[model samples]
Target chain A: MMDSPPGVADLLGVLAYAELTAFLRFAEDATRHAPSLTDRAALGGLAAAEYAHFQLLRDRISSLGVDPEEAMTPFAGPLDEWHAQTAPGDWLETLMKAYVGTGIALDFYREAATRVDDETRDLVEEVLADEGRSQFAVERVSVAIKEDPRQSGRLALWARRLVGEALSQGQHVALARPELATLLVPAGDDITRMFARLTEAHGRRMAALGLPSRP
Target chain B: MMDSPPGVADLLGVLAYAELTAFLRFAEDATRHAPSLTDRAALGGLAAAEYAHFQLLRDRISSLGVDPEEAMTPFAGPLDEWHAQTAPGDWLETLMKAYVGTGIALDFYREAATRVDDETRDLVEEVLADEGRSQFAVERVSVAIKEDPRQSGRLALWARRLVGEALSQGQHVALARPELATLLVPAGDDITRMFARLTEAHGRRMAALGLPSRP
Candidate 1:
């Protein structure tokens, strides 16, 4: 084997841990912030999907002769910190966070997919494939925004903060894992350009939910 | 079509709510109390299974021309109270709760399944089918007991408490929904006999974990 690229394990590890945390956060939001049993079950379904992705990534890490836990441990702190800083306070906020935060992370990973091995890229794309669950958040958030126009400003600010915290945490992870950073923003590619692409995509996502990209 | 059983909706409703709560509780326990990332993911997988069952029951309720949420609403208060009263304090307690509480509930539902309509009985069997996830709890709890013999007494007491609270809240549910009670104990059947069977099954489950049936 030609040494499976420098950061394949790192990328998989980070994504695995991210999916695990996403499962946890989404499950927590479903239990605590969902307005009804129907919504609770809906969010719970999304959480389950995140967990299925976590299992796939973890199994892939194990197949690569790495301890899945050992691979995931390094990113736990930064990701946990990201969730701690962006914990949603209520139902609508929870939906917004799910929509905005997940959108950005998936976009970042999709960008990194281009730099990874074909096998790893396929895995990344598989994990990132939208299963129409995000559309649940979009519909819920959009309907909420329409029902109360004043809420849009607050949700937009929340979305910005979510992206802000994600970026700050992303920088921390990049600094700590240079190889994984290289996977995201290859040797000579402008980091600024990658970020702009992420930001523009995030803007479109926010617009899809009828919210502004900026607070 | 012939009318469904008198309490079929009630049975499905309560069971649906139970599975939903199970998913939420398992996910919460995994995030908050699991001792390792592997265990966390294991519990997350179990949580996902419970959510799948919830979805099935919810869909069954809707298919029967009943509102899923409405069917589930009646049991929410008592079930929520059951969870609120029996919240686990740590990892072992969480495992014990998962093993013991779920064991008793499944047993009760199995007994009730004998009296339900053919289609409903099949659905009940499908939902109650042990997917081997409970073995995860059994192994973990067993290992913990073997590692620290002193912990068994506390866990045994916890198990008793779980059963007691479940029984109390179960009685509350039974009284509030007599038809469901009848479903579990048909006119000619003895409730004491049913309780004995459930208790016997719970004892075997506790024994499987090397824990005392009595505190």
Candidate 2:
């Protein structure tokens, strides 16, 4: 009978707060950038999904006999820093955050989930399931780039900055919680290789959005 | 058939946008004001409910064969103005907006619901139905005011300002779209009397919050 890993709670807490902040930032960005009521409504729907994921994570934290707030507090600084440093400036930038920023975060979480217990891994997978609005970002960004080819240079650069800030802050968060970091790699895996895999997936995502990779 | 009042779609559109903007404003206010993670998560849950209501109204507008954006365009200016003019300065003020401001808006909508077709009325009623978090606002506001009795003075003033701005913008919106105004009163109903009833309910709400009535 092995002791349960401390990483489970840390992972859930970080994920909970991420979903909560994502709800806030996405709703705010949609308010500022949605071009029409239809688009605004769509973004609002996505924000709702984030809130639901937040609740699921928070509830899991509580069921583990820990206060949800205490669990989530450790990662707050790093996540807030990432958002502040990568704050989007316009509609296209907002979509990039929604697509590229959130897309990568989900990618990393999915990768980490594989190293945790089955229950937590199932919860992470449920949260990561597509909410169906990612295509809205894809279509909107692609169309905007098509309309103004010059946007390609600016947006590609923006995506590059997002990746850098995200990875850097992600490292800070991982170091601040070693249990969580340990879960970033399974028993036999290397952390560097895990990061390389994340970066490669990010490049494929940028290519799919018709943007230049890695600056 | 009395030509099935043109105001139905207009009413749904306006409500849709209100819910959408409320979702954004509430999420932003939560980020700014919630004192703890639990409170923050609770407010985020409320914002999610608002977004869900927005979707319901938007879908109803679409089912009416109207473009949701075109239908919502007319009232955007007035609603945005009301929010900008009355932005909350702290957690208590935010709760006031959530409790008092939202209470007034729901009252007005419920009153207007009676004047529309049954289908639209039902949709309005459903959107207006309690999301169960209003009690959170009530308890938090009451506790704060109890701790610092002077807060009642400021909160009462804030609530009054919210009502004034809301009614002024409500009039502007009604004047801008006569069809919607027509829905404020069914045949043989008096608009003045309806407004008086709304004002009375607001007074009662203030009293419930332990604040002075109507300045």
Interface CA RMSD, all predictions: 0.9, 0.9
Report the error of model 2 at residue B52, Å. 0.4
Cα error of candidate 2 at position A66, Å: 1.1
lDDT of 2 by residue, B122-151 (tens): 877786777356778989989998999988
Task: Estimate, for each residue in B1-215, the C-alpha lDDT of model 1 and write its tens digit.
Answer: 14688888998999899999988888888889988899998888888888888888888888899998899999999999989999999999998888887788788778878888788888878877764677788898888888999999999999999988888887788789988888789688766777778788888888877877897
Question: Please, what is the whole-model Cα lDDT of each candidate in the order they appear?
Answer: 0.85, 0.82
> Native contacts retained per candidate?
0.68, 0.97
True contacts kept of 2: 0.97
- Quote each prediction's TM-score: 0.96, 0.95
What is the DockQ of the complex in model 1?
A: 0.79
Instruction: Report model 2's TM-score to 2 decimal places.
Output: 0.95
Docking class for candidate 1: medium
Query: Lowest lDDT 10-mer window, candidate 1 chain A?
Result: A1-10
Report the number of the highest-DockQ candidate.
2
